[model samples]
Target: MLFSGGKLDNQALLTNQAQKMADVPLMITFDGEWGLSMRLRGTPVFPKTWY
Candidate 1:
């Protein structure tokens, strides 16, 4: 599973790596509280937390 590490943010790099591991399914895990844009750019961001 992909986590909060800044390594996987590169789409081109991820795509290349994923192609190499075609046998395995890739899963991206994001913290719902922060939203997917927490690390990467050009994504939706929630203003506040539910809790």
Candidate 2:
């Protein structure tokens, strides 16, 4: 599982390398059910609305 407190640039660099080695295109997606800040540090928190 991915965690917080990591540089996004580093992650992108790694993803790029993996994509090149991959035979098929990889679709990267993020699930921030809570907020971006929950997974990625230093980002603005987009809180979810609860009813």
Candidate 3:
């Protein structure tokens, strides 16, 4: 599970590292809430509360 500012960006980094170590399968998973943003890119804020 990787929760960071950049999801796909982070995945690329991890993939590179994994390739260096050895060829292996890497599964990246994220919470559904990842698509929601309260004030992303300076837009109107819609506060979200998880759980």
Question: C-alpha displacement of 2 in model 1, angstroms?
Answer: 1.6
Residue 15 alpha-carbon offset, candidate 2, angstroms: 1.4
| Top TM-score model | 2
- Sort the candidates on lDDT, descending order: 2, 1, 3
> Candidates' TM-scores?
0.45, 0.59, 0.33
Per-residue alpha-carbon lDDT of model 3 for 1-51, expressed as tens digits? Answer: 343344455556776787677656656454436352421232334656677
In candidate 3, which residue ranges exceed 4 Å CA deviation?
Answer: 1-6, 23-51
Q: How well does candidate 2 match the true structure in TM-score terms?
A: 0.59
Best by lDDT: 2
Question: All candidates' lDDT scores?
Answer: 0.61, 0.69, 0.50
Judged by whole-model lDDT over C-alpha atoms, candidate 1 comes out at 0.61
The Cα RMSD of model 2 versus the native structure comes to 2.9
Q: Which residue pairs in candidate 2 have backbone atoms (N, alpha carbon, C) closer than 3 angstroms, thus clashing? A: none
lDDT for model 3, please.
Answer: 0.50
Encode model 1's per-residue lDDT on 1-51: one tens digit a residue. Answer: 455535334754776687688887666555544766676565666686766
Model 1 TM-score (2 dp):
0.45
